[model samples]
Target chain A: MSNKTITIDDIEVPFEEGQTIMDAALAAEIYIPHLCHKPGLSPHGSCKLCTVDVDGRAVSACTLPAAEGQRIDNNTPALNEVRKTITQMLFIEGNHLCPSCEKSGDCTLQAMAYHLGMLDGHFPQFYPQRELDASHPTLVLDRDRCILCELCVRASREYDGKDVFAISGRNTNRQLIVNSATGRLADSDIETDDMAAHICPVGAILIKDHGYEIPIGRRTFDLHSVAESDLGEIKLSNVRHHDE
Target chain B: MSKLRVGTTSLAGCFGCHMSFLDMDERIVGLLEHIEFTRSPINDIKHCEPCDIGLIEGGLCNADNVHVLQEFRENCKILIAVGACAINGGVPAMRNHFTLKQCLEEAFIDGIGVDNPHIPNDVEIPLLLSKVHPIHEVVKVDYYLPGCPPPADAFVKILTDLLEGREPSLPNEMLHYD
Candidate 1:
């Protein structure tokens, strides 16, 4: 560990020389709400859920490098309110019917909303007519629930070494597209065991025949809040990796 | 103090929230000590009277639902949008992505095993809205209880808090979307 340190919400947090604010904060066991970020993946600050105030400037924590003596505000009420609104935007932007969704209890987006105490979708629902890709033999892509986090896009490209997914279009017209000739997941080279198959933070991409396997009350976010559960999973995975 | 008058209704919902409300079971005997039911299915009341609290389940999908919600909002001092449907246009809102004409066609004419193949457009039938809307979209909602059907303890907790003249706040455990 380097001697360099930064203060998040006035609490001293040590960081290595090259670590981003999110990296340093997570290492220090501080919970900063995020949706598009995963530890090993390259930071894509598209979601803006992890926006934090650094010396009165709001910036995405995942992309911002940690500097010495920086005063960063991670969990302020005003910032949380902004985050809540962003989460609501994500909800209304897509058809996130949490009650009927198979990913309800285990979805990061839903968990994040609950963690933020979001009671309703504050904006009008766009209710966009998106297509569902059930063409895959053992996987399904429901665009209705996608938040466009690009986690699967990064995971497939970086870890799986297959650029099977990419986002197409601009702004509201933007959509996730497949890399195959037919523009369907079944036509792509993706498999059930691929990192992209399991990397979605929302219910957009899901494995077939395994939905609702975990009972409602016993599911991931049901047992623990998103903050605790997400951090705990990361830490636990880190411990397992070290043992290996 | 007089018993607080309360009304409950289900529009396009399955009444699962009401089932969860009744899941309070014997505790409702305790609740009855403080509140009385009006314009609810429990009493088969057709119209809402002026009340202290009104708990509405389901979203507005038809003209009748809209009219009922507006009336319900008018009669209650504090209106609580109960369950996911009432709060965010839950499962029924899935139809929102398709045109009402397509939906009607699919359900009545195009769908398999439909012996009678015509969309209902009788005078007795309420007009279907182009989109399903959460209660708040149609009327002012004082509070929201979110869940597919919110848990029984959540209902009890919100009601208890409101009864004690406190702002209703649910614990993290009680707050869930499913």
Candidate 2:
């Protein structure tokens, strides 16, 4: 543990010598909204929800290490507006019909939208025809709900050692693909207990027959706002799964 | 002060949003003191006359929806899209993934419970649009209140703000999309 402190949004928080701004902020019980960042997994910085102002320049907090006396702006109207736009883009890129979604309350994407006060998609729907892969006996993969955060890809490779998932293609054609002979999850070696199965931050990867097990009003985000939840601790446990 | 005129409608949706508006409960009695309904399903008005604000509660799925929405935009000084359906096509736009013909045939000719099924071609029926569209896709929406139907509190807050001549900005707790 280090005794050094860095200022974030004018609040002083101690940081280890090599801790990133996001890591330090989390250590101090502060949350910088993020989707692609899971502690202990290598930082992807893909979502940019954790982007913050440091020394008057916007930087991704997950990858930007905090230095002594560093001043970071984690929450601002403009930064939140940017995050909302990103969240909106993610919603439109997929057919995120939140009302009918099984992950309506538990999904981090939905939680972040609520945290940022997002009221609409604010963008045109791409209406991309994505497939729902129910080939697996225990899991359902609905590409329509995927935000391509790569949490599953990282979890499968780093934790489960299965290397079962990887993102493929480029730009709008980008999609999550199963590493199997038939490109079906059932054909893969992933089991119901795999970390990849539970690591998805969206409704894209779901364990069959497990949906709505916790009713909508009783789910995580329903009981507490994302900011109110112990999201840092949640990510810490997700990363801790790698050790077990 | 002149009473603010409000008009509302639901299209291509479940009318759950209008129900949420009604969820304002006793507050509706208070709201009536400052506002008047002109062309809402709540009052069963056939057409919109000039109004101060128009609240639309669904997406566009047919020509009639578009016609009514456009009329709202033209007749009202401000138009608000009041739910997920009106904001981003909500559940109705789920059909955007399939071809219009596929949806029609599945509902008419090939559905499991359909009896002597055929696509309706009656001149009296409004033709279904090729795709469902949010209110903004057809006409400009001046404001949006997102939610499956934004919380009853959201309706009260926004309406109260507008009635008092302030721009409506929902507090985070009042703004939800589920």
Q: Identify the leading candidate in terms of lDDT.
A: 1
Candidate 1 wrongly placed segments (more than 4 Å): A235-244
Residue by residue across B56-175, what tens digits does model 1's lDDT show? Answer: 999999999999999999999999999999988999998998899999999999999999798877999999999999888878899999998899999999999999999999898888
Give the TM-score between model 1's chain B and the true chain B: 0.98
Q: In angstroms, how far off is A170's CA in candidate 1? A: 1.2
lDDT of 2 by residue, A150-224 (tens): 989998888788899999999998999999999999999999888899888889988888786777767778878
Tell me the lDDT of model 1 at A137: 91
| Candidate 1 global CA lDDT score | 0.90
DockQ for candidate 2: 0.72
Cα lDDT tens digits for candidate 1, A1-244: 6899999988999999889999998888899999998898899999999999999899999999999999999898999999999999999999889888888888899999999999999788888888899999999999878888998899899889999999999989899999999999999999887788888888899888888677887888888888986677563133111012
Where does model 2 exceed 4 Å of error?
Answer: A230-235, A238-244
TM-score of each: 0.96, 0.95
